[model samples]
Target: MNTLSYGLLSLLSFAPLSGYDLTQKIKPLWQAGHSQIYPLLASMEQQGYISYKLIEQTDKPDKKEYTITEAGLAQLRQWVEMPAEHPVLRDELHFKLYSLWLSEPQKAKELLYQRMEFCQSELDRYNEMLGGNETLREERGESHEPKATTFGRYMLIRKRIMDMESSLQFCKYALEELEI
Candidate 1:
């Protein structure tokens, strides 16, 4: 299955959601736009992974409330148990670092510092969300179907926090190594 299929399945496994809702939910985690999601949703439905209901709305356009099917759940289980596809590690920042010998030390230092800010910003956002999740668990006692569905995301966000922390540390070391 494609990335979009997995994403849509992951969302629908939790609860029925409209296309707009799916787009909003994935904004911070992935870079999908509406143009990509709608088409993929149609394709997944064709593959017997998902189905939807048209909800009547007087205030706005009708919505497709999508849900996962038995096949989708099976697919999701297989996806979880199967080894991950080789992860991609492409980043423009790495290219910039590789080209550092041709750039001025002061300029490189500035760029590295900018990266520090960027990583920290992402770290801070995730930290805030982690805290919020804790509060939610305390207040509402997160359980049932939603908990089962969203657990992967909770693990994902925590892993990303480690990534950001490591990135920030790399920036600091790179700057000091440059002696700038």
Candidate 2:
């Protein structure tokens, strides 16, 4: 299944949610466009992978909340067991680092410092996300269930936090190594 479809299923596996709610839930990891989601929702519904119910609002337009079908659950379960594609990190900063050998000592030090600052901010954001997950897990009565995506989300965010810490260390070490 496509990433969007699989992503939709992963979220729906938790609870039924409006598209707007889903977008907010997914914003941290998914940079999906607003235009991309609505059409995909319709397509997933048409494919019998999902379905939506309309909820009436007193002073607002109706909301379409989507949920995964049994078929979708089966697909998700199978997909989870399959080996995932290797992740591709398209980081501009990493590209810049690749050419650090060619940059002047002063320029390289400046770039490394800038990267460290960015990593720290990102680390803080990921830590905040981790705290948010703790609140969510507490509310949901979360357990270490292998089947639950909450566990996966928590792990992924933790990995990012660790990655940021490593990145910061690497930058500091590079500065020292070059005596810059």
Predicted structure with the largest TM-score when compared to the true one: 1
Candidate lDDT (C-alpha), each: 0.85, 0.85
Misplaced by over 4 Å in model 1 are 134-149
Candidate 1 per-residue C-alpha lDDT over 1-180 given as tens digits, one digit per residue, 9 for 90 to 100 = 787678778888878899999999888767899999999999888999999999999999889999999999999878867777787877898999999999999999999999999999999998888777764445434453344545666677779899999999999999999994
**Model 1, residue 89: what's the lDDT?**
77
The lDDT of model 2 is: 0.85
**Candidate 2, residues 46-68: lDDT per residue as tens digits?**
98989999999999999999999
Segments in model 2 whose C-alpha atoms lie over 4 Å from true places: 58-60, 101-107, 132-149, 178-180
After TM-score superposition, the amount by which residue 108's alpha carbon in candidate 1 deviates from its true location, in angstroms, is 1.1
- TM-score of structure candidate 1: 0.85
